[model samples]
Structures are given as C-alpha cells and as structure tokens.
Target: MSIRSYLLFSIYRFEYWMQKINKKGAAYMLALQDVTKKYGNQVALDEVNINIKEGEIVGLVGPNGSGKTTLMKILNGLIVNYEGEVVRNESIGALIESPKYFEHKSGLYNLKYFNDLFGTKQDVGKLLEQLNMDHYKKKSVKKYSMGMKQRLGIALALTAQPEYLILDEPTNGMDPSGVREVLRYLRRIAERNNIGMLISSHILSDIESLCDKVYLIHNGKIKKEHRPLVGFAVEDKDIGKIEHILLDMQDASITDNGIVKVPKSESKKVSQLFDEHGIEIKQIEEKSVSLEEMYFDMVEEDYK
Candidate 1:
C-alpha cells in the first residue's frame, strides 16, 4: 500500500478506537459512593453506593418508609446534606414528590415555564404532541385530573431533553389508560433518545415493563437488583423428581427446565443424566422471570 493510503487507514483505526473508548467512559451517568444522609438523630440514608449507567432505565422499588424517596431526592440534587460522594455526568431533569404545578396556569404554560428554566426554546406544540396531551395543553392544570397533572409533570421534566432524568413516585394517581400512555412515551425516551432514567414507583407492572432493570431498596440501603426474567413455570412438586435425576450436579442454577444451567464444562454431563431419567422434556427453553417473582427474590435475598 502507498504511504498516503497507509496513513489514512491508520487514522481511521485510531479514530474508531477513540470513539469506542469515549463511549465506554460515558456509560455511567450517575454514581453514588459511601453516601450517608442524616436528619439530626434520624438517618435517611446509610453508606449507600449506587451507579446508574447511560442508556439504562432503572426503577427503584421499595415499600413506603424504605428510603426510596430519600435516595431519589439525593439523585435530584434536592438534598445537599449527604455525607458521601454523589456524581452526575450531565444536566438532569427531575420531578420529585408531588410535582409542583401552577394551579392557575394551563398545562402548556407549565411546560413553557420549565422549558425556560433550562433555557430551551423547544416548541410546546411538539412536546404536547409527543406526550399525546395536545388536547389538554390549553386547559388549566388546576382542572386536570391527577393523571393529567402527572403527565404534564413528565412533559415538563422532559422539556430540557436532559441526559439524566429522575422521577420519584411517578404515576402516583394515573388511571390505567393514562399510566399506559405515559409508559409508552417513557419507553420511547429510553429507546430513541438513549436517556438514562431513574424512576421510583409503586406500580410494579409499570416498573416491570418500562425499566431495563430494577433496584430494590430497604432500610436505607439497596437490598437487591436484577434484570427481568423470561421463562415458563416450574413447581416445587417437580423439584424432587428433578433432583433425583441430577443429584451429581453441585449448586446448579435450577429452574423449571429440570436443572436448567450447570457450569459450561459440565452441561453435557448434566443433560445426559437428565435424559437418562426418562424426563419428558416438554419445553426446554430460556425463560423470562416475572417481575413479581423478581420482587420476591429481592425481598428474600435481602432478608436472608
């Protein structure tokens, strides 16, 4: 190859590697380490460390008084008295607690007001369209139903098109249809804009479908976390039969598929053993774990 062509190739390779490295570094949108928050004698958060990566939609799940709100407040930069380190890589949009709305102003006005806060000039018309709330834009927020108010709040928070978005107790009072509409847009935000969203909600189904992963917090700490599971059912009645089929396998991750996963090297041995047991493999497939099951696992693991 000519020196000119060689140099061009080298430059292209260098640029590609640099971009990959930059993207990897940009993955983490937020990180909290050894964080502690206190209110006189009451500790709201205790030595917490959590990291939120870019392009990740994470749902915070916890019962009331479990410190879910406190963690979200710290994330929104609303609580500055924390004892540990909190880092956010970019600008954020947040609506925490009950979103403060202009009772007298129309929904469009609220959007415009928040847009001005971030010094953005995006058209309210377009935002309303995206949120599927164009019909209610001109109506007074005070007249809006609880669901409508939450939708407007979501629209307002997203007006800035922030890199980091945090919503605490989102969908507090939305009707089923309203909640579905909101989740649809939130999913679009994650998929299309690649925004990292930290949402705390009591709606388990919404969290299951909307989030890339879930974070369970308890007693001011992150008790557990997991990605969703996809799978068929496995009953305890079948466990005994399956165990007899493969008692040789040590600490295998067992599920309904009859000793589902073993170490890669031992997979063949386990499979052959199960096959010999005359186990009618009805369906041996990868399965997604249900959100309810995941929640149970989170609680169980935390307590154990």
Candidate 2:
C-alpha cells in the first residue's frame, strides 16, 4: 500500500478506537465493581457488581437481610466504608428508608425545605402536580395517608433533577390503587427524563412490570439475574394433545393443572398451530410469574 494511504487508514482506525472507548465509558450512569461491605465480619454485601445505564430500570429483589438494601445503600452512598470501585458519572437522587418530615409541616413546606437544601430551583408546585399531590399540598404531612406520603417521598427524590434515581420500596405500605399510581408516575418520569433507576422492592409484581432487568440477591451475593417471562395460558379439554404440541415448541411448559404456558411473543403462532390442529381452544389468557415465585425458587435452590 502507498505511504499516504497507510497514514490515512491509521488515523481513521485511531479515531474509531477513541469513539468506542468514549461510548463504553458513557454507557452506564452508575457502576459498582466488586463492591463489598461488612459489619464486624458479618458480610452485608459480598463483592456485588451492578450497572445502571441511561433510560433503563433495573430491579433488585431479595428477602429480608439478603443484601438488597445493603447494595442500594452502597449505591446511594449511605454505606460508604465498603470495598470496591463505585463509578457515578452523573447526579443522583435517592429515597432510601422512610422519609422523615416534620409532621406539623405541610407537604409543600417539607418539599420546599428539601428543595432549598438541595440548592435546586425545581418547581415544587409542578412536581407536586406531577405526583398527583397538588390537592393535598397544603395539608400537614401527619394527616396524609401512607400512599400520599410515599408519593411525597418520591417527589423529594426528584427535587434535584438527577440523572440516576435510587429508590428502596418506593411503593411500600401503599394500597393497590396507590401502588399503581406510584408505578405509573415513576415509569413516566424515567421515560420523559431519560433517567436510569435502581429500584429495590419486595413486591415482585411491581418489579416484573416495571423493570427491564432484575437481579436476585441472596446470602450477601447475587444469586441470579432474570428476564421476566410474559406467560400465556392455553387450555383445552384434550390436555394430553396440547402438552404434546407445546412440547414440540420452544419455551413452552405444561403446569400441573394441564394449562400450557408459552411465551407471549409466540402467542399468535401458538394460536395458529392450535387452529391448524383442530384443537378447540377453551381459553388463552396472558399471565406472568409472580416475583414471589421466582424469588422462592432461587432461595430454595440455594438452600438445597
């Protein structure tokens, strides 16, 4: 090759390599590499590694005392005396444990106090409206319901307009409707702001619905990572025939009650196959495995 051509190729390759490196570095908003935490030799966390990237929601799930909270605390800088590298590339907002507010103060006053403390000019009124707490903004926190207070805590977390959010049980102690409201707002906020979030929750259904990926922790370590399944049930009178058909298909299983569980993505194909085979479908309902089921499965395996 000519000397000029070789020089140009080398320059192009150098630029490409630099761009790749830059992209990799900017991909994750927060990363914990080989992080470990201990309390008087009782290992609260054992070399935990987690990464949260832009515009992604990651769920942390485990039973009590299983290092989920410890991992979150480390990420939030609550437990700082830990071992490992923590890379936080952008501003963070966190709501860990119970939010302490002056019971006598109005919700708006509490928010205003935090806003000033964070040195942010975020519009408290707008935030309250977004969280559906505007109506009760003037009411004292002591009079607020559990769900309302939870929403207020989330609003406090957003006072800083952080690039990453860390929430531990953001919906704890809420009724069904309250849980739905909190999850809905969280989803909207994450999408609209392009924020990455690390959420730890005991409610598996909330995790399964809201998270793009899930990490299961146990015994101070990450036991498993799971992509939650979107399950579909196919039921018919001839259970044996349905089982045989599903057995031939990938990612299909028959439950103990003769219901066939297939991936939701393949629901159309399964329906077509059933029709072609003259299997009169009684019902085909979409469902998901509860987080409780997945958690217990992992825990049981670990104990065994």
Candidate 3:
C-alpha cells in the first residue's frame, strides 16, 4: 500500500479501538458522576449522575433554565469550572446552542472547514445530503434561515465522526417535518455508527420517541430516572379525590384531562383506593405514559 493509504488505514483502526474500549479496556461509555456546577451563588447542576454506552441514545429532558444546557456544555468540554467527574472514553462531537460560521461562506465551505480542521476526511457533500441540506449547500449562512442553520450545525458536528455526540436542542428552530426528519436521521446514524448520544431537549415527545433512557431534570437537579406510567381516565369530579388518594405515590398525578396517571406497579393500590373511597368504577385502561405527565408528577412531588 502507498504510504498515505497505510497511514489512513492505521488511523481508522485506532479510532475503532478507541470507540470500543475505555481506559480499563471495558465497554466504552461517557459518564457524569456527582457532577455539580454553580454560578456564583446559583446552582446550575446539583449532583447529577448519568451514563451512556455506545449505540445507546440517552436524553436529558427539562424545561428552560433547568440545567440541560449546563450538563451538555460540561460534557462537550465547553465549560470547565464545574465540580464533579466527567468520564469519557471515546472521541466526542458536539452541537451546542447555535451554529456559528463565516457569514460570507457557503454551507459547504463551512462544513469543509471543520472536516479539514478535524482531519476526519468526511465527504462534505455526502454529509450535507445525509442532513437533507444538500440543496442549501451553496447558500451563504448569512442568508440561511434558522432551520437551515440548525441542519448545518448538525452536519458540522458529524464532521469528525466522533464516537460520542452531545447535542443540545438539535431540533431547535425546525418546522414539524424537519424535527421528525432530523430525529429519524439521528436515530439511524447513531445505530449504524454505534455512536453514543447524549441529547438535551425540552421537547418531551421528541425525547420519548428517540431515546432508550431518559433523565428528567428540574431546578438544577435530576428528579427521576424514567419509568413508564399507566394512565387511567376517570370522571372530572373524581380527579381531585383520586389525586389526594395517590398523594403518597410519588409518580402519580391527575393530568389536565382528568386522567389519573400512576406507575404500572401501583395499579392495584389505585384500584383499592377508588374502591375504598366509594368512587364509581370506570374501567382502567393501561396505556403508555407521556413524558409530560411524568414530569408534572415528579415536579409536583418535589414541591410537596
């Protein structure tokens, strides 16, 4: 083989090895343990713990100002003055906040810029195509809309082909269709490349549809690890009574539509409570829990 070809081959082998092992030669993973961050007197993240292994899609779900960005920034090595441990065993690529580029440069130009900088030898044109941004490749970023720029940001993040990806609100500014497309593409690439992803988004539906595990954060703290709840619809009049009865259940809440949601394991308790309360029987149908419902329950429980 030519000298250049041999060098390229060796690099690929090294990257693959890195992707598969940590310093201990164990399965690769990115982790945050007892991670805490504070800005002056205000805490940004409080004792956060999370882990992601190759080919796994883990999500950080929280509302605005809930430390999702703070966590992602720390993982991406953008913020350094935090207290805690961040364990990373593979190369990382990140798309955080906004995508910045030379205003006068075309999307293709900006992508190529990063590709060369990382020495990843990515085909810029193909990357654009994968992101559905090929049609806009020749347009200067200065003229690009928010959605287009978002796509370009993701494309740039993939330039290095890093084994771990930290994406913050990757679908921000996209239309509904664009959001679906990006989520699908991200899932495909993550699985195909066995890339571990740590994604932060306030969009619970998006997180629910894409992630294998989810960490719900609120008030700069992780409130709960995700567990599916079964929702039970009841009369509006009984909503208050049902909620009161389930008060002891940290994961139970009466949603806005008069549906009482509780952990699947607590279905018996819920049924017994209604029976003892002399509440009329409506068949309880088991259904998948909405992230929003679970978030509401956890946040309310936290306040109590």
Candidate 4:
C-alpha cells in the first residue's frame, strides 16, 4: 500500500485499541459523584451519582420538581455552587434550554456567527444538511417553526465537534411527529459521531427507545438506575400458578400485561416447571421491559 494508505490504516488501528481500552477500563466521559444542590433551605439534588461512558447515550428522567433540571445544570456548569465532584471531558456541548439566536438573522447566518465566536472551522452547510435543515438554511429565524429551531439549537451545540452533549427537554413543545424527528436526529448523531450524550426528557417513550441506560431521580436523589431490560416472556392461562412457582426466584415478576418475565438464565427451569405442573403455555418469546413501566414502578415505590 501507499504511504498515505498505510498511515491511515495505522491511525484506524490505534483508535480501535483506544476504544477497546476505554470500554474495558470504565473510562467515563462524564461523571458526577455525590452531587448535591440546594435552594435556600430546600435540597434540589442530594447525593446524586451518574456516569456516562464514551459513546454511550444516557437518559435523565424524573417528575416535575424532582431535581432533574438541577442535576443537568450542575453537569453543564450552569450551577457550580453545588456539593460533590463533577468530572467531565474538556470538550463539551450543551443545549440546556431554548437556544438564543438573532431573531431576524438567517439560520445559516446564526450558525456562522457562533462558529466564528467559538473559533471553530466546522462546515456550515454540512451541519445544516445533517440536521435536515439545508433547505431553510437561508431563511430568517423568525419564520422558523419551533421544531426547526430545536434542530438548529442542536446544530449549534455541535459546532465545536465536542465529545459529549448535554440536552434538556429537547422535545418539549413539539408535536408527536416533531418529537420523533428530533429523536431520530439525536440517535443518528450519537451513533455516527460516537459521542456521549446525557438527555433529559419528560417523554418516556423517547427515552425507552433511545437510551442505553436511564437514571431516575426523585425528591433530590438518584433513586434508581435502570438498563434496557432483557428477559424471556411466557404467557399462560394459569398465570396464578406460574406466579406461585416463580415467587421464590429472583428477577421474576408478572407484568400488568399478564406476562411472566423470567431471567434468560432461568428459562429452562421455568419451562420445566410449566411442563411438570401441566400449565398450558400459550406463547413464549424474548422481550424487553418498557421504560415507562419501570419508571412508574420506581416512582411508586419511592412514594411508599
């Protein structure tokens, strides 16, 4: 191979090795340990710990007044007077809330302005194209819809090609279609660029579909950490009998949909139990637990 090709190949191999080491070593791009924030006498965040590994997409979810916003602010350095250590990658991008732009300027012009301010050499046209906003690149921001604005906000955050992104309620005020569009763009950006993202949203469905892990906060505390569930699903008419059999097994529960969730490791035992008890199995399949159900379950338990 030519010298140029050999150099490129060498670089690729080096990058692959670095990524492998990062994964095995738990090299987090951002981490917040025992973070706490207060407002007057009220605690907004208490002993919250979170970590985002390189190229991972993490979700922050909680009810209103549940300190989700406060935690996000701390991550972005918007609130620095809080307790705890926040370690983050030096190169970071964020869209905490609504992005500010010249109302009368074109979208492309606004992006160019920020690019200049940040001394970044990012290609304006390519950024707009990636966000599906190339057609309206020259249109005045005043005429852009809310969804369009949100897309532009994301483009602005990406101007510096940062390694990590922090977004708060990116789909707020958007219609269903708009929400889906934004989510699709975000997922594509994260995977294609191999960037870590911490996204906070009230939309549980979006979180369920996109996030690799989720942090549920309640009453100023990191109440629970949930991963995308993986298990076996068994449906039987004798649901009550099956429940009794699996009662002593850990990680076994019957969902409200009347499906018994058994750990994949215990699938054979579950099958044998059903056969020995003569319980009729209507269907069996592999399934994942919905984030909405998990969120509600966590919140309910906290209340109790």
Candidate 5:
C-alpha cells in the first residue's frame, strides 16, 4: 500500500480502538444509588436508584410532574441535595442548561477559555468544524440565533470529549431542522466515540428517535426502566378501521381507551391484517404492554 493509504488506514484503526476502549469502560459510567430528592413536603425523586452504562444512549422521560429534570440535575452535580450517592467519573460533560457564553467573544475564544479551564489541549477549531459551526466561529454569541446557540452548546459539550454526556432537553427551543441536526450529530458522536449520553426530553417522539432505551419517571419514581415501547399511533380514521377489523375478525377486541387486545392464538393474524390494510397501529405486541396503556391502567387502579 502507498504510504498515504497506510496512514489513513492506521488512523481509522486508531479511532476504532479508541471507541472500543471507551465502550469497554462504559458498564457503569454513572450510578445513582438509592437517590431521593425532596422539596419541602414534596418528593421530587423517591429513592430512585439507576445505573447508566458508559456507551449507551439512555433517554430519560416523564410526564410534566415527573422527576426528569431533578434526576439530570443530580447526575450533573447541579443539585447537591437529596439522599443517596450520585457517583460519576471525573470526565463528565454536562449541557444541563444553555450555558452562558461571553456575548462579545467569538465562539473560538470561548472554547479556548473552556479548554484552559478543563486543562485539556483539545483541538477547539476542529471540534467546532465537526459540528458545522466553524463558519460561525468568529461571530459573537449575541449574533447567533437560538438554533445556532443550541449548535454551539453541542460543540461546547463535546470539547472535553468526556465519555459521559448529560443533556437536559438538548433540543429545547429548536426548530424541526435544528432538532434533526442535533439528533443526527449526537448519534454520530455516540457511535464514533462511544459516548454514553443521558438525554431527557418531554417530547416522546424526540426521545423515541434518539434513544434505544428510555427511563420513564413518574410521581418522582422510575415507572419504566430500559424498555423501548414500540407501537403504532393510528389516526381516528385508522382507529375505526382497526376496530372494524377486530370486530369482524373475532380474534381481538378493543379494550378501554382504544387499545386493541388480541388473544395469543391470533396476535400475528391481527397484526398482518392491520399492517396490510395500512392501519397505523400505535403499537402491537403478542402480549406486550405500553407506556401509555400502562400509565392509564395504573391510574385507574390507584383510583379504585
């Protein structure tokens, strides 16, 4: 092989090895041991213990009153209170908030300062370039738009190249295009660098897109752990179609709140018919439960 070809091959191999090393150490990047957060009489997080692996994309989810923000704060050392141990390694990158930057300073200037503080000689320009923000490097923070600011946030978070990244609503205030860009870039980083990410978003669709595993927190406690809830969301028109099909087929019945429950003998048959008819199924399982269904069921049971 030519010398240049050999060099490029070696570089790729080195990058792969680095990712492998990061992945190997990702078993327990962050561990929350019996943690609880209290705000006066309210329980923000009730004795929640969670272990996040090093190189996994774990999305934290919950309803409006859920403890996603609290859990993230505890993980990022932003909230020092609560009971239980928040154990994390030294190298941790947190975008828990849209961190303030020097309004008058160029983006590059900001990275230089951050790199100095972190005592790491990372290539700041290349990092910005990788995030497609190199063109915006010389501009002051004040000149950047909100979406640009989010892009800058991502660039800053990756500057440390920490194995663990904590993102709190990473795509908040972003347009659809911006959200897509951020998710794509994050996935690239996670795959390339084996960066373990803890992403929290109130938008279930965003969480579904970015994470393979999700943690659902409700009532200050973890309601679901490491479960990817997959189902279809058929429109009202499609719902009627599904109902009609179920009624005519006799193997399945529509349960309360529009859930189509199927007997084990005909789950596959029901799924095939609906899929063939272009019925947008919110979800279908042989005998699997869903987050939405599970929540409503629990609520009804509690009321009783």
Candidate 6:
C-alpha cells in the first residue's frame, strides 16, 4: 500500500476504537442537539436537531436563504458561534458553496497540494479516476468546465478520507447527466467508506433520491422530518384493493392520481402483498416524495 493509504488505514482503525470506547455503544456518528445560530439580530438557524449515523445519508432541504447554508457551515466549523450543542465523533470532509481552486493550477496539483497541507497522503491519481476526471487530471482547473470543477471540489473534500461529509448544493453547475453521475458517485463512496453524510440542497429530487432521511427547514426552523417515500403507481386492475391494503401501514395514503404511496422500507412488503393478492403493478414511481405535494403541504402547515 502507498504511504497515504497506510496512514489512512491506521487512522481509521484508531478512530474506530476511540469512537467505540468513548460513545459507550451509541452508533451515532454525528449529532446536533438543538443547534441554533444567528447573524447579529437575525436568526439563521433555530434550534435544529439532527442526527446521522455511520453509513447513513441525511438531507437538509429548504428554499434558498432558508438556513441550509448556515447549518452546513456550523457543522463544518466554518461558523462556530451558535447555540445548543453539536456532538461530532468523526473527522469531516466538506464541499460548501462554490468550490474555489487555484485557477491556474492543474487539478492534480490542487489535490496534491491539499494532501501535503493536511498530510493526508491520498492517491491523487486514483481519486481523480474514481471521479471520472482522470483524463483531465493534468489540465489546468481554469480551463475545466463548471461540472469538472465541481467534481474536483468533491475530490478535494475526500482527500482526507474523512469519516463524515458535509456537502452543500454539491450538484451546482452540473448538467443533468453530470448531476446524476455525481450523485451516484457520492452514494457509492458513502456506502463503500461507511461515511456519514449530511447534504443540504434545495433540489427536492436530488434530496429525495439520495437521502435516507430528510429534514425540511423553513424560516430557520426544522419544520418536519421524513423517511423518503415511494409512490407505487398501480394500474390495469384493483388499484383500490392495493391502496386499501397499503393503508394499513402507517402514513400510507393514495394520491388523487391513484398512486399508492408507502415508505421505501415497505416496498418489498408491498410487492409481496400484491403477489399474494394477484394484484398487478404497472409501474413503481420515484422513491422520493412528490416535490409539489410535500412543498405545498409544508407551506400550508407553516401558515397554519
């Protein structure tokens, strides 16, 4: 193994033991207990509570200027003047806001630079390959496209092989295809490295697809939490029967469009129920809650 790989492995093992010994069997990798922040007189975050376990991906969803950036900044220690408590049990890698790089330097050089600065000893070549940017690794960052720069930003964040990640609008400047690829890479890396990740994004589809749990923030307060839901679109027969059967599950409901919704956790059970009852499912909808439905619901509740 390379020096960087060896060092990272050693650190990972050491931290693993430390976490076990210190937490007394708590599996939480990071916990925010009533964390709040303000900018002068303006409250940016209001008593936000969140938790992310190792290997779990959590999403912070909100409109622009709705405290998402503030919360991420606090988690990354870029902004520390806050209220309540943040319990972090792991090292973090982050890509917050626009990823800034030495415009004239090669992407590889930037990675090597950070590695040297942090003594991380990362395999810069391998990292770029993983990000599908190896071909451009030697190219100047100034000549790279927005999406490429975004990928480089992510690569920079991972150079430390951190136990946790904080990504703010990680898909910014990427085309749809680029966005999908980045999300796939992120999910794969999180699972492979057992990294706890907290991602903040205004794009509901991205959050819905990537996050296991989601927190909705509005006006600086966490308005609600949800496990991303999946809508099973039943057709060609007995939709009502399937919907009726699913209703027995908590929060299972049918939309006006005849889509039966259930938690992603229950998707297999849903299929089994259908198979047993001889119900035919025409299609499975996306796994995340409908953005319009969820946003409208939150807006109404906020006004109430």
Per lDDT, the best of the predicted structures is 3
How far does residue 105 in candidate 3 sit from its true spot (Å)?
0.3
Please give the lDDT score for candidate 5: 0.71
Spell out the clash pairs found in candidate 6: none
Return the lDDT, model 6, position 74.
68
Cα shift from native, residue 165, model 4 (Å): 0.7
Off by over 4 Å in 4: 1-26, 231-288
> How well is each residue in 8-115 modelled by candidate 5, as lDDT tens digits?
664565444333222334347676778888999999999897776656688877677678878887776566657777666546787766676777889899888778
Lowest lDDT block of 10, candidate 2: 15-24
Query: What does candidate 1's lDDT look like per residue over 79-142, in tens digits?
Result: 6566776667666788776666677888988788767765897787787888778899999988
Residue pairs with backbone atoms closer than 3 Å in model 5 (clashes): 26-54, 231-282, 231-283, 232-281, 232-282, 232-283, 233-282
lDDT of each: 0.71, 0.78, 0.80, 0.78, 0.71, 0.79
lDDT of 6 at 289: 49
Model 2 spans > 4 angstroms off: 1-26, 229-292
The TM-scores of all predictions, comma-separated, are 0.71, 0.72, 0.72, 0.72, 0.67, 0.74
Over 235-263, each residue of candidate 6 has an lDDT whose tens digit, in order, gives 64465676677667876777777777777
Candidate 3, poorest ten consecutive residues by summed lDDT: 19-28
TM-score: model 1 vs. ground truth: 0.71
List the lowest-lDDT window of 10 residues for candidate 1: 17-26
Tens digits of per-residue lDDT for model 2, 215-270: 89998998877654444344465777777776766677777776666654356677
Lowest-sum lDDT 10-residue window in model 5: 17-26
Best by TM-score: 6
The CA root-mean-square deviation of candidate 2, after full C-alpha superposition on the true structure, stands at 12.6
TM-score, candidate 6, is 0.74
